[model samples]
Target: MNRTLLIIAMFCSASTFAQSPVINNAEIDGSGAQYQGNLGVNQAAGDLQQQANARAIAVGHGASATTQIRQRLRTVVDPRIDARSSIQGDSFSHGNGVLGVNQSAGASNQQANAVRISIGTQPQSIDDSVLRQQNVTLIINSDPTDSEPGYRQIATSDQAFTGSRGVIQLNQSAGVGNRTANTLSVRVTD
Candidate 1:
């Protein structure tokens, strides 16, 4: 009986270790309590492109050709945050905090460019010139300021915690031919 119990325990422990751990894409806290700290988060990218092209041609007298080009680009930034109080507690006890959530997906992001060309003529003149240049600069300052806060500070603070909170959330997409979708939100429940 002792040997059998030992074998079973070993098997259980092995199985537990073999199971995969739970992983989440975003940060989340379940504890219902006030948080005090300074948060500086930065997410940036250089360049991104998504394109598709199709071409069909026929040179004979009675020729038929078909061409189709389809392109799709979708970006979803959905963050699920739940800070509800399970039992009636001090839900508005948040203190002075500095939070900065900067999400700069890409500088020169090109998406959903589809081109379809069909030519029946034999001879034609073609001239093409393409020049691309991109430059991006991002600066963020979270220093405490005793002076009056402007619209930028108020907007960022409103989305974060309550009380005297100085938060800065900047969502920027610089350079030419940039396409992006950004979403930032913070909720406090009582």
Candidate 2:
């Protein structure tokens, strides 16, 4: 029978080239979508899969926050003051990682604020080749008197690494005061 079907087609092509590459199905679906920013996947004899979905607000690398309020009445002078502040950070990794964040604020009658965050990871398996990384940071500061002196700050970072080993980085910052002493920043170093 043709030499037993050519030895079962050479043992099914050597078991499909020694079988070992799987991630069956990957998906990212958004109906009525507003925003979908970043995603990556790799497969060409080496395997890597990654997915990040639905992000309204994302920050990385050096982070911070601060908010404020103050009021005064004449003559006998009555001062009623209200103050507010905030800060946040995030980092993610599979192998070889670093993340960071910091924030600050100050006022005359006195109001101050700060925030910071960091994350890291290393050593992964399942074919022994995959190093993924992500970092975020933000900072804000504010000061107000005679409705003139004020400041705000923001910072951030982001990264993604894959099979032949992939890597990514992102950062952002914004500061406002003194009739809009404005600043907004961004950095991406592959």
78 Cα displacement, candidate 2 (Å) = 27
Tens digits of per-residue lDDT, candidate 2, 1-190, equal 9999999999888977886633222111221112122322111110121112111122343321121222221121112222122222222233232221112122111111111122213211222111122222122224354553223333222322221112222222222110111111222222
Best by TM-score: 1
For model 1, what is the error of residue 111's alpha carbon versus the real structure, in angstroms, after optimal superposition? 21
Please, what are the lDDT tens digits per residue for candidate 1 over residues 1-190? 9999999999889977785632211222222235465543333333333222222344443333433333343433212211111112332136444433333332233322111223343433222211122323232335455433221111122323344354323333323234432222222222
Cα RMSD (angstroms) for every candidate in the order listed = 23.0, 27.8
TM-score: model 1 vs. ground truth:
0.22
Worst 10 residues of 1 by lDDT: 78-87
What do the candidate models score in CA lDDT, each in turn?
A: 0.32, 0.23
After the best TM-score superposition of candidate 2, give how far the Cα of residue 75 lies from its true spot, in angstroms: 38
- Count clashing pairs, candidate 1: 0
